[model samples]
Target: MNSTLLLKKLYKRNLQPVLTDLKFAIALLLIIALFSITGTVIEQGETLDFYEANYPLHPALFGFLSYKVILAIGLNHVYSTWWFLSILVLFGTSLIACTFSRQLPMLKVARRWSHYTRAKSFEKLPLSTALEGRSLDQLAPVLAQKGYRLFQTDDKLYARKGLVGRIGPIIVHASMILILLGAIGGALTGFVAQEMIPSGQTFAITNITEAGIWARPWLPKDWLVRVNRFWIDYTPGGTIDQFYSDLSVLDKDGNEVDRKTIHVNEPLRYKGVTLYQANWDVAAIRFQVNQSPIIQLPMTKLQDVNNKAKAWGTWLPTKPDLSAGVTLITPDLQGTFLIYGTDGQLMDTIRVGGSSEINGVTVKLKDVIGSTGLQIKADPGVPIVYAGFGLLMLGVVMSYVSYSQIWALQVGDRLYVGGKTNRAQVGFEAELLEIIDRMAGSTPSLSAV
Candidate 1:
């Protein structure tokens, strides 16, 4: 009864809750995975009408899954979600717990050799060996011949081989921790900003995630940037082949600090800020005013109709009258001609989209202003994120490429060898038997299971 109780205690203490921890970890990882996958599928940072019109089959559903929902629930943007961050924290905690609770003691045992008596229970283990009608003589020399360091205790034998097998979980956990550390480092210090600037125009990256922080104490004082020029290339089939921009950075004094040419794939890096060519548009049109320029009398109060007509500008196709006069109002891309014969009198109106003839003066629509769009980023933790990705890949590689073991013991005259592996033990066992047969200078048909 005492032995039974002792065995029960040993089992309870030695056994690890590895499977339960793994299940929890896997579920957390899957949630993060789902968010990542969904981020790719959904068109992020777009207007609600876009989703509603596009997903007309489920308009109400799309409306519910609008930007507000995404922003509130952290779905439109996944990486910065509080719940996602918490999951990562929990994953790291669980990994640390599993590592310490189970792997540390196993490593201690594997690093030290213990004596095992020739009892009936010893042969019951899957990779167990028993001596048949043989005396334990010269056991040390026999074990030494099979590359096992052996120690003896009265009637017991202790042997160990490939002790490094115990460190497999440690290495795996260490790499996972490294990856998690890298991710945390990145999340705490990453930011991205975007702006549109016309040629020969300057702009500052003021806002991120629609949140502007003008009073950031640690931000650079002179975060001014400029675009000297922007260019676009097209393919023969009218497709956008490539795009680039010439950008300049300035300090507080507005001195020519630095300059770089950034392109679609190529980005300019300075002071942790990277400038990329995001997109381009038309802005700031330069066109001629198609009317005679002159000044009109200023009448603050319209006491009389004649005085009110004199207050109008003399630039357009209008004659001075008590009621109306022509006023030429021209915008960049769209122009209009107004013919007012008196004050507050609608004589005639003409827009560029349509045609109008007033006093034989015709106007034509010209050009519009063009703009170059750029996306700038200053992520102090991008390198760390990349490092994390590399470490994660390394963990997978190590987990997949498992290093196994073979243990050979000499019982009397017969050489008994056993094999074990944390994973793929059957394949390794067959290979071990084949190696043993070859060492004995005989061909044994070892079938791989």
Candidate 2:
């Protein structure tokens, strides 16, 4: 008796109720969805300066949201936060627990057999009937036509259709578990970083924006990325039509391993790492002074309110006193520069490989070098997450199939029939009527016994 009471207590508290409670599952789903929405509406993983500039305290966003509040709550990196991860883990636990306790047990009940021995049992069913002179042989043929698996013992028989429906809940729970596992794996092992590499230069991954604590940073160790060239195409109105970056992957010994020219939305994947062309900027200018050695002049942003466009410029002196000089200005990396005279007038326009006289000094525009911004990422759980979603779709479709079941007993020429179903009650009722009509036809006599 003590063991029986203890077992009942365990079943109620630990084994059965916690796992099979629909309200508990619903609560977990709601919590997960709420947090997911929060994660989406807020930006993630930005610099301190960016947050400060965007989310100021004086006139805070929505009257209360500021950078200080965001940083304190770790909203900048929601996906990698401990609380968000804990929610995922708890939701996964609920799915796994529900799978074993509720779904599997329901499936077992669907598969198990129970022969109705008494006609009163048939009366207890949602739909039941008793008739004279109909046997199991008359009912089996009709049930078989409807695709039910049969089980029989002496005068009793059980039949069911759509056993696949019983597996649907299990599949749904299992797929959810897989999805949660994949998300956790990605959060633990993936990394995101960005780099800005100038044209004709090679780079390795060093600027990490956000990475999992357990992420392996030394990935693709033997490979390096080279930005061979960066250029942009312009429309007739001088608007940017497109930009491109020609990239190549090299090995440790400096052999070309892979190559591709990537644009916005196009990317290159090498050895589990993906590089996307995300941005572009002017790096420096190559200039020469009257056939002398090449002088690389680093360009600085022109903060002059005189020109209301994004432009870079550098000033080169022609006189020893630095009083008379020319300012070379470029709006883009299109190999074109606008030379401004000391009196702020356009002196001459120079193209790459072209020369012009500025303050009696022959000045040439060698090259306008540009930099390419690449966003790099490595994720290992994407495939598993995709598979989990596939299974989720399949399971939802299968769950709609309606698992209908029936039982019959022919005891000494008196027929008994009963039926039950989880879904599609109208369909199950129609099937029952057809079977009843067939049995009444085969026996040639019928009565409610």
Each prediction's RMSD over C-alphas, in Å, is: 10.8, 3.9
By lDDT, the best candidate is 2
Off by over 4 Å in 2: 1-20, 302-309, 317-324, 341-346, 437-449
Give candidate 1's TM-score: 0.64
Q: How many backbone clashes does candidate 2 have?
A: 0
* Residue 208 displacement in candidate 1 (angstroms): 3.0
- Candidate 2 per-residue lDDT, tens place, 1-449, comes to 99999998897788667656789879888988887887788777779988887889989999999999989988898888898888888778778777876779888888888888887788767777777778898889889988988998879999988889999878888898889888888888888898988899998887888888778753567888989999888998888888899999999999899999999888998877889988888889887878678888778777556445688898876665877788889988777899998889998899999999887788877888888888898876677899899999999999988888898988787888888888887778777887778765642312222
Give the Å error, residue 52, model 2.
1.3
Candidate 1 per-residue lDDT, tens place, 1-449, comes to: 99999986775565335422678779877887887798788665544665555444444454566545555675655665567777778777777877787778777866665544334434433454433433334345544575655665545555555455566567677767666666655555555666777778877777554211221432345757878877666677645687768888887777778898888879888777777887775443222224544232211212244333211122332343423235443221123435454354656765544545554444332432335677666555566657756666655555564344333344455434343556667765664554444353454443222
